[model samples]
Target: MEESDIVKDIEKKTRLTSLKKYMWGPNILNLTLIIMVSQQQFLGRLSLLSTVLLLISIALNGITLIFFSKEIRYEENQQGIHKPFNKLTIRLLIFIIIFFGAITIGYFIR
Candidate 1:
């Protein structure tokens, strides 16, 4: 490969790395929420602050998914692949939705 090609490849990898770093914020938030939910007493309810945190976490997760999906689509397009739904992406989406639903239900039932 030419020097220019090597430079371009390095730049692309750096961009992807930066994007992945952006994703970690939401991933950590989701994990924290999961831990908190698990520790709650069976009969206890989410407080208003916890509900708000859940909402923020869900929104952050959604945004991360959107950024990741766009990156996957771009890569697929560049490689001439036609995968419409990546399994990991689908799992993340489902998990976020389930978490959001659980929190919403908990808020209402409190």
Candidate 2:
């Protein structure tokens, strides 16, 4: 039961590494969501297809965020030191919240 063995086991069980290709999932989904919303504004019409895509993208992003959060806690625990979150992360979280709220309002407005 070496420390390295424990860390490796944890990683294997969780299947989460911040450096993995899927780490881009959240960013890509976020971009897609914004594009879907913006297209409606420019075209000036309700699009059921865009709405369905937006919901799917948001759900996928939510799953990605859960993995990201788990990885953050896993790394922090392994380091034995709890660090404050990055300013950029905080700003991005805020931006996501505001945009999500706007989307909710837009969904109801139309």
TM-score of each: 0.59, 0.55
State model 1's lDDT. 0.67
Candidate 1 residues lying further than 4 Å off, grouped into runs, are 1-3, 37-39, 42-46, 79-85, 104-110
Highest lDDT: give the candidate number.
Answer: 1
Give me the candidate number with maximum TM-score.
Answer: 1
Instruction: List RMSD in Å for every model shown.
Output: 3.9, 5.0
Clashes of each: 0, 0
Candidate 2 per-residue lDDT, tens place, 1-110, comes to 45697777676545535434465767676766755664565646567776767766776776676667666657656656466766346745765785677577557656
Give the Å error, residue 80, model 1.
5.9
Per-residue lDDT of model 1, residues 1-110, tens digit only:
45697777777767666766676776777766754554455646677787677667766776776777688567556646686767667767677676766665565565
Local lDDT at 107 for model 2: 72
lDDT of each: 0.67, 0.63
